[model samples]
Target chain A: MGLIPRTIHDIDTPAAVVDLDLVRRNIQALQTYLDGTPVHIRPHVKTHKTPQIALMQIAAGAPGVTSAKVGEAEAMVAGGVHDVLIANQVVGPAKISRLCALAQNARITVAVDDARNVQDLSAAAVAAGVTIGVVVEIEVGMKRCGVAAGAPAVTLAQTVAAAPGLDLVGLMGYEGHTVAIEDHAERAAAARGALGRVIETKALCEAAGLNIREVTGGGTNTFDITSKIDGWTELQCGTYATMDAGFRPHSGHMFESAFWILASVISRPATDRVVLDAGRKAVSFEPGGTPIIEDPSGLEIESLSEEHAKVSLTSQNPDLQPGQKVRITPWHGCTTFNLHDTVYVVQDDEVVDVWSIAGRGKFT
Target chain B: MGLIPRTIHDIDTPAAVVDLDLVRRNIQALQTYLDGTPVHIRPHVKTHKTPQIALMQIAAGAPGVTSAKVGEAEAMVAGGVHDVLIANQVVGPAKISRLCALAQNARITVAVDDARNVQDLSAAAVAAGVTIGVVVEIEVGMKRCGVAAGAPAVTLAQTVAAAPGLDLVGLMGYEGHTVAIEDHAERAAAARGALGRVIETKALCEAAGLNIREVTGGGTNTFDITSKIDGWTELQCGTYATMDAGFRPHSGHMFESAFWILASVISRPATDRVVLDAGRKAVSFEPGGTPIIEDPSGLEIESLSEEHAKVSLTSQNPDLQPGQKVRITPWHGCTTFNLHDTVYVVQDDEVVDVWSIAGRGKFT
Candidate 1:
């Protein structure tokens, strides 16, 4: 049997390729780390945005899944996944209505840091005659969302406790801002510092006699550090299952390279420079850079446009032909995955499955 | 009735807001600029990727439409667009098959810079029993794609002519590298210099007795400059309809603010800063910056994360509290539009229509 069922030329260039064995191994490793720990694994679905991946994670002992948008949660529920947490606040009537509707089938929880949002959630849940779980988001150094560590977070938790149609589930804080620190020691130190604040806030909530069933936070980069937090009931890591070039430097675990963009060199008119078929439209630009060329020794991707990538070779490699195929390991796999509609799941180089990112383009 | 619809709040937060009046005016202005010229208009659909917007451009006197992917062409065809140009090269079996299938129904044209691509196109066309229109892409200023300008381009044109199942329709070149120059006079001067090389290649092809009917190039930033080129026959401008924050400084015509991200302030623990509900997931970061705050009083967007946007407010505006709504104009409208599934079309305070970005997530 062929190691790769399809040759590089057989598949379309600029397509998102996922190594199935790597994804399975990543899941197994993460599960192994959390073994005998109280922390439940609730992997974030926002990374893959595919229900198939969510089911796989659940099968590997994940308690549930988390999504960034209500539309994504709804899609996951429709795909037969029962539990989902909209880890961000859902504002406006349209999104609130959708959230209420989603609660009819699945266990839906949302994070809120402000009291006004509590009112909105309560009203929406009351109108729908369904109770929605609300998690008080405490600021954990991201400085992006959530209330400050102590009194402010306690006030929000109190409001959630008093809200008629809302259930005060627990306290949640995301140390996302410190996840991708280039220095491994510094990243782990910052993760502990940030999660420590959330632990303090959880203590305050417990003192107020609040029922804190779950405390969730953590991303792919800080999953190892977050697993050691005393009060964190769940780790919400997403990008671990599909390792990217950007995460490799910060990740503490042995994450297999799972995602690659297959592209072909379309132009090689100059001796030093070449161009590929994939560019900003095919991949993403979050890391403010282009993908690393997997072949062509000493070549570096210099720049990218909407439909083409320019690669400059430092030394001559006779095997680097004009039409040769190469795989690009993107810097950020989550954003790159969001750019595509379908991903080919390959096991042992054969495309075992073609899964749709069904919840993609649900930004609203 | 209010000029701006009230349904804006009900539609969805972080939704794309397009000003129809502004879009119509932009189309009319571009059409007026090319009034007495022989150059035809073929707006690139990769920017909008919506059939409704493509139809509007065609109705505004565009000769045809252009796209970067076969999936985009297929979506446009389903939306009733007949003349479509896949302005990028299609490689590998899957994409070539789709490109050939698109040619079965529409007047399909594609860019070819490689001799092997010509053979691939010919094989696909012959297999489908269709004649695909081929354009010899010439490198002007953007080093990303296209064969080199003089004899190399002529050689590719000759190859296209010799191909049995392809027609040598025209030539295409994109000076995208120079489009973002902040200085107006310098931008026009740079565009003229680069396009001069492209025009020279066209002349060489003509002297060799090749039938070069249409010569297309230019994006929204350089539409006016490229339209004035003597040998250029068509303009492929796409971003004119929905001008982005980045293009505002370059565009001569004032297209009303069409797109905005409506985000609610979710946290305001500090008097100097506030966090918004919309973050990196809802916006495009390809421009390598945060969204421009629509408020005129100098509220700076500090930073962005996966689900939060930190805004720094002026000391004078300390009263800006949590739960208040704010509008954010993204740096790149094209990528932002692709991030969402449905965009609301509003008129006089109501949602007049909802258009699905059908070609979204078609990265393969």
Candidate 2:
């Protein structure tokens, strides 16, 4: 009656919708890119917490899944993923014990930057009667975690090898600072430079007489750049499955926007201004900007509250009214993914499937 | 022994914790302030979605709860809060149907800015054989929703009164723009000026043969200011129960911060730099600021990424290390509250209870 959705007429507003075709295309494109490469693609499950999607990625070509937290790894296993790698550091006994228990049903791997955390994880795995794979994380550019390159990383690898129930597998290095560069040439150069350091650290690990098996790193931002680089056994890319608006300004591979927020206009106060029901809680405003409405020039975004986004009309060609459904490309895919509980997988105008955000808020 | 919490020490990192004592104190203090006023206090449940805290507010003198979405209203009703007022616009037939259903079980009321929405709501309520209270939302200073001041609001009120199964309860005017003023006198004067516009709108509605039962307005930022204003029968203060750092710079009421994020340091990469396992997903980067580390000079927060917070130590006296627990006072309470699933209610050093964030992400 008022430009309402013909197929998704009954579903609630402020819902996350995934275009199935776009998602498949994205997954297939990335797989096609890595088809002949020596590196494997281990998709990070943080972007889409659904095990169904994880299974889909695995069926496509993923060897295993990457997790950010132990709870997320547990949820992924619960969702049917068996081999999981927690790419972030796992500290303390509680989380380590949980990780060991998860290893009972699946092959578990974790990253380590601290020797004490390595010892703790090894002890927990030994008590649980399981062996856990360990990866020494080397700091390239992102100063958040991981040991410094060279001697420090070598020492951490030695610690992992000495610990019982823990097998030193490889090293991980995240080039987070260089991944978001807008310039294609600059970003590629920066990625290669940062990854050069990671490669040096891998050489250091090899020199230390550790039989390194796998090397994992990279994100959706540096997916293409790292794919061309040698020595990384597996690349962890999460946001490629559902590209965000933040990547548009710096996309080298040109992944299509696969995920969008479907929201209904709930209030139209003036002819010039209308308010949508999706805001910070429903849609995330991260990676430095607000989302782009499906038609970029249609509505002007005024401000966003916790539960509302106010937009002013810039043109009158397609006048917006209350009850009209619109789509928005999220600014950051991972942050947007964490905000929702379920995602409606759509094909054409109708909802084809619904997937629970199995790992949403699994912030252990 | 290796930094493993025996009890809650195992309950992952970066969790929201609420002090029940502070909740009670904030509720009592607000009630005491409203005790002398002519207006009633209806604590908005948006701050703390837990039914236990809402029940606490009710026990402390709240008549009902103000919800931003229908899902929150449903959760409050499920938690035994019978009288609920959704202080935002409720649009669409599907949402209106849900509102009608909730109305049958409880005394449900809503705010309206558009006449068509009022008609839709009225039709749905009539079909459901339940009466719904309608409040014409008046556009105060911060205009996200609601009709323009005098005649526009009067027309919406007339529409509500003329529609079957609808009662024109009162008006809702949110002074969001003036609520965050730093100076007490300026904030109070601005709130009074905004409330005066709402009062004039109420009078206009009355002159048009519509009855005004209640006039609700104000937020935690301007609770005291609006309480002293004339013609406001009820004040809706959401953030008073759990104070935030945004109010600290310009607090008119100085409500003690009850809500905090308990995080574990997972990485201490450098002597000067440490990383806490809380970030935008754990603690929201809203209202344009980072969270205040419980002790101001202990650790200086550098930045918050998707799942990690990089902090630099300011003082070496209280040495910060990995796996040490620290509390953070979030900059904005409402946005931060929507990011978690559970809130650990701690009294002292130990967690006494756990409250499910029932209304978190209830963006209908």
Candidate 3:
């Protein structure tokens, strides 16, 4: 099912390219994984930052969508995703008020690690005359968020349960540190250790007279490992839907690479070196560097400027010309997706679907 | 003239905070520098990526605005900046056609280093029934774009002169490598050496019976050094309008810091460590790293994550608490502007203006 547009050469280079067939297949595979498991999937929208992809996950039987910011959650709601969870803390009156207002239209939940944040969120929800779900974030190993796993996490859960206008909704912990780990066995072991802490924290919360029902955690990297976590009820995997080249090496779950940055070779000054039109400005450098060049036999990307990428080749590939276009699969798909406003869903070579990153650039 | 909406705590954290008073003063300072010089100011719009900033530059007597992409130029045109130049190469049929269409509404010019690109641009402009201005880029040590200094550049200029429906405007070179050099004398020497090559290239073009009028180049770091180049007539400074914390140590100019990413402390688990809401997603890591913490009492940003920044204070800052908000001046102002949809232009503590980063996320 390739569209193969007649004017393929007319497309701009460094544009976010998506293979629709691959994306659909990726979605189908993730769906199959969740179907066999008891874990409910609530894919993180922060990965794609697009309502179209979020809806696709929902269509594939996701319970809801997860976002890192209240603005993104609000945008997802506006774009027709009914259930949204801010998987991070919601602080300040502006954001808390926004999150509470969003609950008026859709199901809105937020993660909390500290007592002050819960108090602020409760006051804001009370002011807005709405009750918001709050998930106690348990610190596993990431050390970025949440309180200490056992006692401190239970204490925070108690605070959330005792807070006014706040519904304590289970537990949440992000083992993001294990997402990009290379070794399968080691990654699985680390995931088990981290998720074990989350499970223990949930047990402590239950012993402290709190009813825990929905324990949500896990990313695309640890979906398999976390699927077997004893108490985890929901998987927050998002990147599996639009797999990048970096994930190909680690993911035992085979997912076709759907994301590609179409860039043109603008300069070939020396026979050994060529420059692409796309650079840090187009694709992000969030995953430490630029995309790995897919084709052009002997070339290696050396460095990136704002508008150009310097590539050195051992020998020039006969297929590559100065003006020829090539597709680049970025190291981190999530960050690259956020950098573009629109992503073209392509098959073969033609563009069949145009999807706006509805929540793109919503950092606030 | 300060809006002072309420207090610093009243506004949301992790928002793009701009001091309009500082921005105006910076603009005036740049205007003052170019008062007696023959150099034409064409402020680069890639930094702010906003039409309001471009309009302000025009109001300060800038002849035109420069953009790194065709989409940016289009946004400026829509925002009412009629004179625009795509300071980077415009390759492939889609971008060329778009550039030609943009030329139909505004004065559009682009930089070129190859003969084939010149032909492609000419063909697009001819098909669109418009004439496009072309600037022949010379190699000036950055090695990113441009042909060799003298004869090669002259030959490219000749090709541009011969091309149909294209006007050879001038010569341009970017000494990006020398921009951020910490040593003042060494930086000036490097700028002189690089601009010397550009001057020699212009003489070669003159000898080849080509009239080269405009010679444009210089970033925020090298503006002063390159301003003294003999043949250069345009200063294309972008970041000066919104000085970042990263450039403050080396700016050598009295531009006030205008941009700050306001973020709240989300976590305070340890007595010494505090985590902020802003992280890699909000600010770019290109120039060096994330924004430095601008807390009143001495504070240092140790590390950052996707959603949290682990900030360690040298001593306890009485002002900073778990829920207290702080301001972060990013390392690179340009990419940080692209990460958000709207920037709150603040005076004192009040949001005096809110401008959409209209051209943001236009990676394609």
Candidate 4:
């Protein structure tokens, strides 16, 4: 059960609350599953953006933490996590300059798909007299980023080897396509194929005389599949720490909604409809329509404006009135986490602590 | 022309940039149109969230500003704004207490659509020894967060009048349904009808012995319509300061896109597809759809992940490449503004100043 919010009544509405019990349970589940597995866990910080959560995950056996931006890496370093991997490409001098500064103290690794970005990182690293780890990202299945898997990976690794102040650690690939699918079998099959591509790229790199130490890939949805694989080094899972509504029901794993937006009923205009103080601004209404509102029987989130969430009472929702607090589970945790600055760490009915999302809006 | 970007190139990518020239034009347009009219201008701070913009609007003859939440009002007051109307309801002890505390400094007003909430507000106001302004929110066209127009509004106004420490301040009704319609005449006709309901409620409140002083309603889209109406005392326009993609083309006035997410091309995976550094997290991708990518020929925003915007090229665009900066115009400015913490206020190419979004994620 979540913590009782006995002391949380005084908190204003539309607050982002993370249930501590659920968080611990979620982390414990992941640790238990990967306890003896060869695959190491480097939890991605994009979902929480809080250094404390990453530290907690580190304490729970995560080797390090992953960030999507250079600013996030700098923030995580500030949060005292010395080992950081920026899982996305770092382009341009403005960011590369930050990367060079970050590499001065921490063990910084960054993903690169393009040769130009790799060259830029090399120049920045050389300028700072810091040797940075490089992970050539391969185009597994999510065609958004990354170079082609096999020969292209070798070429990138060769470039990394040739560049001064750069060490080719391994490769990284994100199986984003299969991460949130509904069907279990299809997602598992797709995960196998995606991870297979990464493994293939790794072999090609190794065959080309590249030393592959850590192949960081996989996410919350496919971590199990990658853990069961032979050559996968680490899992950069983010969502298993705080599950969102986007995760479909499956027999693969059990992850509950650990984080939610605590909203209050502000308008009770009609018997069949009500409005909450929180809407798209507070809750993460992803590409997947509206977020799931925690039980107010027979009431469904009809639509959301910028500041108001209009809920339709299809049946008798007599208890739903103004000032009553409610919880909204978001569709996606990463994007939702970006919208908040602080998280009210709570138990069922009471807030226990508050953690600042230190790396929020670190897009630069 | 936007201010020259002499120093903007060094600011990194995936940053929110505001064209100061366009912002001034948008505000000037609203002020010019509303000048000498019977209606009043009260710019809603939900769009910009910066007290500087609110101050600018006030300096441009806006009587006051409107906040979606009490926290936003507090933020504005901290930025030296005294007259603020939180045009949403203030229910619950926590919010009402804060509102009361805020009223000690700022001339605060709020909207209500229920009697119990009115009683609660009255009790809170009486306890705080502060008089609060109350406006009955009539359900005009949008069936959300508002009471019925005529008698129900009168009933609520009577409750406001009877309650201690509360002063009835006429009514508020927003015609959100017609704001984004493509057809101008239809939207204007709907705006007239919507404002007509609020006007009728004011008459009903007067006939029912409730003295009405300020009738505040209407938004950016319907401000033109409300200005033509006879009884609209004030206009709470928000989006006129920074426009979005959802607003249909209207010949009534020219409103340029002032706010943009300056994103870098992170990946050029294929000749026909490129990924932007800014995604759904950076740009405000509302339920409406993807935001418009400016100046990219034959390229359309195909999809957005949490951290990557995928743009598909229908035709070969030889010029577009990785590391190039692009501007994304959001579909909803208010929600978009909430996602960002600071906006680089640029004239054209060079950034003139940077404003911290003081009210960002002020969900309460």
Report the number of the highest-TM-score candidate.
Answer: 2
Model 3 lDDT tens row, A152-218: 8888888889888899988998888888788888999998898898898888888889999899989
> After TM-score superposition, what is the CA distance of residue B256 in candidate 3 from its true location, in Å?
2.4
DockQ for each numbered candidate: 0.51, 0.75, 0.53, 0.76
Using lDDT, give the best candidate's number. Answer: 2
Ranking of predictions according to TM-score? 2, 4, 3, 1
Fnat, model by model in order, equals 0.49, 0.80, 0.49, 0.82
What is the C-alpha lDDT profile of model 4 across B1-364, one tens digit per residue?
1233456675677888888888888899888987888787999998899998999889889878999888899999999998998888888877788899999997888998888888888899998999999888888878888888877778778888999999888788877787877687888888887778788778777777778888887777777787788877888888888887766355255688888888888888777778889877778776666688775544578888777888876565545677887778887778878888888887657778888899998877
**Model 2 bad stretches (over 4 Å):** A1-6, A295-297, B1-11, B295-297, B314-317
lDDT of 2 at A95: 76
Which digits, one per residue and each the tens of the lDDT, describe model 3 over residues B205-269?
89889999899988878878888787789989998999987777777767878888888887776
Measured against the true structure, the TM-scores of the candidates, in listed sequence, are 0.93, 0.96, 0.94, 0.96
* lDDT over C-alpha atoms for residue A361 of model 4: 82
lDDT score, candidate 4, position A255: 72
| Global lDDT of model 1 | 0.80
In model 2, pairs of residues that clash are none
Displacement of residue A177 (Cα, Å) in model 3 is 2.3
Candidate 4: CAPRI quality band: medium
- lDDT of the structure predicted as candidate 3: 0.81
Write one digit per residue (lDDT tens) for candidate 2, span A1-364. 1233436555678988888888888888888889988988999998888898888899999988999998899999998998999988887766777888899999899998998888788888888899999888887888789888888888888889989999888888888899878877899899899888778888887887888888889888778888788787888988888888887566665578889888888888877788899988888886378788875346656687888998877567367788887788888878888889988888886877788898998888
- Model 2 chain B weakest lDDT span, ten residues long: B1-10
